[model samples]
Target chain A: MPDLPIILAGVINGLLAGGIYVLVAVGLTLIYGVLHIINFAHGSLLMLAMYAVFFLFKPPVGIDPYLALPIVTGGAFIFGYLVYRWLIGRFNHGRDENILLITLGLSIVIDNAALMFFTGDIQTIDVPYAGRMVELGAAFLPVPKIISFFAALLLCGALGLYMARSDTGKAIRALAKERQGARLVGIDVDKLFAVSYGIGIACLGAAACLLMPTFYVSPTSGHAFVLIAFTTVVLGGMGSFAGAAVGGFIIGITESLGGLLLGEQLGQIGISLIFILILLLRPSGLFGGKG
Target chain B: MSRGTLALCAAGLLAAILYPLVVRGLAGAGVGVSANYLINVGMLVFFVAFIGQSWNIAGGFAGQTSFGHVVFFGTGAYCSTILHVTHGWNPWLAWPVATAAGALVGWAIGALAFRAGLKGSYFALITLAFAEVFRILANSVEFTRGGLGMLIKADQRPENFQFRDPMWIYYLALALCVVSLAIAWQLTRGRFGARLVAIRENEDAARALGIDVYTEKVKVLALSGAMCAAGGTFYAQKYLYIDPSIAFGVDKSVEMLLVSMVGGAGTVFGPLVGSLVLTAINEGTRSLASVVPALKNVQPLSLIVYGAMLILIVARLPDGLMGLFGRRKSGKRHDA
Candidate 1:
């Protein structure tokens, strides 16, 4: 049997993977909380940001993926803002299924467009830390993962503070909690909704920037993370930011440990089985029960 | 039956049977020389229409928009292919068995989801999760050949479901489409169907009105899933191949959704209309590319068009093409 330290490292690495899921789930939760629309295209949008980082890392626009974070995230914020203003706004009073259908459609378009423009080829952004690992006692942590882990926590804290203090953030919370009450108080509900949507997307953008250093960006790669994100969101309890973070870590650890036990292929099966079980056991999810 | 509906159904049947014959006649006369292409496209149109019709029963009538419908399709394909290739059973003989397997899966899924009380987007997401899990299993398992793909010998034997001419397959698919359309028409044109529509319109009201909402949804899902499996078996028979991706890909689920939504979600003729439109759009783009060199490489243009179409349908035409006639109000309820 392997030493306890190796198992400890696996658990740690799983938690590391969970950090990215945390970022993704929090964004999805935030959007669902405010917009009452599940953004099925969230993963695809994140893929676009990944491509942005890939391109920004090369040629005359050369910059490190980390360095391009502010630009890509800011760009995503603006893009998301436009999406809210134009695309989603059209369905303000539409049926719940409309959002589902439109987002499914958006995913199809974005994924196919990427395939057309980028030609289905995998694009990797190589960082110097690709091969670097940090040793701790008898365990090891990859440099890229470490960077992403910290970045995710940092963004989570920032988001937490923003929601707690910022006027726009408070407006969003108010709008989510009591739309009529907020409106009576002269809150620009629509504008606040758009801002919340943009913030949700910006959170995704940060995760994408962090993910680019370690993962290959492809039109189809987002499919995996999309499932993972849904799993995390569901487990964390829908529309709960803190739950999303915790749920992310749980899924991460579950997937990682399951992978270690079952040899990767069957590992995913076990992990998914657990996900279904969780759903069955707690229809409301593991944390907050609200939508 | 209403005169208009009767006439429309009769006209549709005539067109379906005659369309292939006309194309074959054109081929015999050596005119246009693209009759074969037309026939193939017609097959796909019918194939998708049948599958989409299955989707309509569960998603449209029952109002349980499943995003993992390809699960049944994959089940049927794998069941039939495995029975035929490994057990040496005739492919045609294997189809009914595969279809039964598919129905069983549908029942199991319905049991789990409905019993668990998953509704709306939650139901859809759980279905998607199930499909993904199955996809991974299919890709990993040894008997499935694990992403290497499966192929049946092309040996021309009618007994083994092999055909010298592709037209036979096309006709078979068309027959399946007609049968499925007929089934859909029968189901949706009754008091039971009205109950389904009511359930979709408002689940709580349906229950309050003494409708067995759970039983109706499950039954509809089983029927839909079984029919979808039949389409899958036909696909395997026609192509004589099965791969994990081809069988259970999310693309297939979306294809069904697009066809149902594009035509009209709760309308009888909507899926067929959606199928025709999608076929024409894809074919139109491909044909246009043959003439325009610049457009040749942008194969995804059609998909982008589809995406835009989805958005347009949801945003503008919630009732799809049926809304154009102003015959009925939108079945989907507006969100506050």
Candidate 2:
């Protein structure tokens, strides 16, 4: 057994990791809710945001990567909106397989394009605060990761509040819950879809910016996080926003505890296995409303 | 079978058997051809076709769309390699055990996933998770040799499945391709095949019609896994090595899906055509890279092409390449 301090550190690590997972999974759940299509390219979008932040902070511009979050988020939002309008809008409503195939294609294109542009060498932002550590009485935590954790929680809260309070957010939620009914009430389905996609992409972009300080970015970097994101989303419930957030934390904690108890390699697999078990036991997820 | 169907089958069989000989003769006659390269490419095409067909059973016919079919491939490779290397068992004898293991694993996954009512994207995620777990397990286990991977023993006799001749390996792969294709054709044409299509089209309706959806799905998954496992066993033997990265990799699973989609998922001959085209593209790209120094950094170009093709095919030709020429008349005829 590990010491008490070590266990505490593991719990904290899990919470922080869960925060990042929520950032990615929430976007995924949002897209699924409106479009009824699981955007397979969602991870690639995160990778693109990371690259954007990386370039924005490169030598000449010299803007701090963390400071460039707004630009990255905005750019990703526009890109996501355009993608939905031009590419996703063409598919028939119930043809979910077509959406899956198309998004997969887009992911491949984005990943390869990044490969061509950035090459395969892994790149990371060398933020000043990235290496800094905060020492507690018996535990140490990386500063950037702590910052990322808070940022995730704050953003999620803001997004949740916005959805609950804002008129546009209400419209979007109505659109998700009942498209036909929303349309009968005169909500613009197309416009709502585009906005929802933009929001999703913006969420991913913010996550990428937050993650930039702590993780390496590469052409195939999105692939590493994408599967985990998918697992989190599924564990949270296919299209449930609150479920996604809760699911992210659950997965994050599982990964942390698994790493502490098992080896590092097994930790990832253990998290995935736990996701599978949860899926088998409760396909809708812990917080997911019954479909 | 119809006369046209028999003719097509005969032509395909002749082409498969004679292709190697024709290529060998061309090389012998001092044509601008490399027999070794041809054989290697042929082996890849055969294996790709075999695995693609295997995946098609569940993905295309049943519409489950698993992204982790490589789990079976990896299991088969590991099982056969362990038996051969550790126990000194014959490769031919080890194949059944490998296939059985794959079937068992597939059945377990299908039973759990299907019973829980996971469908579509969720099912895909579950399968992908399973593949990752297998890869991680294979990577961490000492007996599997971890990251260093496993290599066939040098100075071993040819009968031990380590052959000095690429021709022998080519023939074995080719035979497996034929067997796989035959099985796919048979499975897709029978009552079980009809039941699969029914489930794919509408599970609720199929269940209303008294179809045992759960049992059928598991059976299809198990059968597909067994076929993929057979391919893996041959792949391990021919490569004279096995590794978690190569065997259980996500790329392999994507390749299988791409081949089926490109060639036309529900069609019997789709896998063979898709495999040949994609393998040729892959080999050609690699060759071009070697010849052109400037193109050396195009690491994932092939995957990009595959992804693009998948999107285009699904969007434009949902019926796949076979739909371009003509629909499979049998399916329509039977319906009528």
Candidate 3:
């Protein structure tokens, strides 16, 4: 067996990884809470934002990803809003399954479009701080990972504050609780939906910015995150923000420990198994209300 | 079915049966088309249609809507491949066993998921997770070669289930398609199919009406799984190779769903029509890329078109393209 310090390191690494997952799942859960449909395009949209960061950081522009965060996030918000307005909104008239298919189709389009344009090459940004490490008890973590973890937490807290305090957020919550009642009370339900979707995608944009220095972006990068985000969302309860946060951390640690114990190939099974077990047993999630 | 519809189906079948011969004849007469290539294309259409029909059975007819039907496909492929390659079992014999294995897996998943009362997106997500778990296990296990993939020896013989002639595989695929269509026809005409339809419309209502909703769902899933597994066995035998990604990938799931949805879910001829349309689009894009030269790597154009079409179909053509072929119905019944 490995030393306790090594195990502690694994746990630390998992927590850092989970930070990114929390951000991703936060967006997913928000969309689910408000729209009551799984956004299959969540990963693809994140991929697109990653591409945006890549271009902004490349030679001609040479802007830092940190600097590009606001631009990318704003652009993502508008893109998400318009996509909902033009595509997803138009198709939202039937069974919730229709939205699932629509988002899936949207993901396919986005992923393939990325493939055609981005050429499937994995792109990474070279930041001076990339190799820097911070010592935390028994673990030595990358500077980017540490920064991202804190930033992710900060973002989530900010989003929570916004949702609890903002008028638009209240409207969204009202819609989620009762769509017809929200509409009856003079809330512009459709616009609120678009805004909620925009905010969700905007979270992805921030995540992409946070992730680029530490991770690689490829056309299929979205596939890697999609399942993890789903697992996080499901584990945390489908539409609960706090649940997603805790769930992301748990999943991250599970992945790290799973890799440590089962070898990398079999270790990946942990997330999927957790997903299945949660769906089977406590599907409402750890802190979620009735599913 | 109407007399007109029956006549249309007959004409279509006759055309399909004659297609290979006609292509070969034209090629012999020095036509532009390659008989081998066209024949292979025909085989692909039917193969895709067959698998799509499997998905349609559970997802459409029974309203299960799984995002991971490829689990059964991969299970069948790996099961038969392992038995034939490692255990020295004849693939012809292993084929049925693999199919049964698929059915067992289907029943197990159905039992667990249905018992949990997991419906809609929760059910879909759980199935996807199961596929992921299977994929990871296949990647880690020593028996599956740990992602090096398993390859059957190229012993080209009829007895080994490996055909020297591509035509044999084509015929096999065509037979499978016909069988799938017959099964779908049975579903439409039988009490079980009606119960499934009732369940799909409303589970509580179906239960109130005395339908064993859970049992029927499980049964349809088993049937669907068996059919898909058989396709997997055929795929392995035809290609003589099995890999984790090729067998259990999400792409296959998307393709199956795309075909059924675009063609018309819950309709008998939906998968066939969808497969043909998609294959045409795929080939058209490939040839178009070749012609344009500058668009040489624009191969994803076809899938982009498919994705767009899926969105359009769900938005506007809920009944799918098959809906266009059939008359507008007065009620919820969409059988064509």
Candidate that scores best on TM-score = 3
Scored against the true structure, residue B188 in model 3 reaches a CA lDDT of 86
Q: Which stretches of candidate 3 lie over 4 Å from their true place?
A: B328-336
- List per-prediction Cα lDDT, in the order shown: 0.84, 0.84, 0.91
Q: Extract clashing residue pairs from model 1.
A: none
Q: What TM-score would chain B of candidate 3 score versus the native chain B?
A: 0.97
DockQ of each: 0.64, 0.60, 0.64
Tens digits of per-residue lDDT for model 1 on A45-104? 999999999999988888998888899889888888888888886676645767877888
State TM-scores per candidate.
Answer: 0.96, 0.95, 0.98
**What tens-digit string does per-residue lDDT give for candidate 2 at A150-257?**
998898889889988999999999998899999999999898899999999999989988998989899888888887888788787888888888889888888888
lDDT of 1 by residue, B96-197 (tens): 998888888888888888888877887888788787788878888988787886788787877888777767778888888888877767766678788888
TM-score of chain B of 2: 0.93
Question: Against the correct fold, how does model 2 do in TM-score?
Answer: 0.95
Model 2 per-residue lDDT tens digits across residues B42-135: 8888888989988987888788888899999998999998998888889879999999988998899999899888877778878888998899
Docking level of model 1: medium
Question: What local lDDT score does residue A168 receive in model 3, on the 0 to 100 scale?
Answer: 87
How well is each residue in B1-336 modelled by candidate 3, as lDDT tens digits? 689878988998888888889999999999999998999999999999999999999988888899999999999999999999999999999999999999999999999999999988788878888988888999999999979999999999999999888888888899999999999988888888889888887889999999999899999999999999999999999999989999998898889999999998888888999999999999998998989999987998889999999998888887788879657422133321
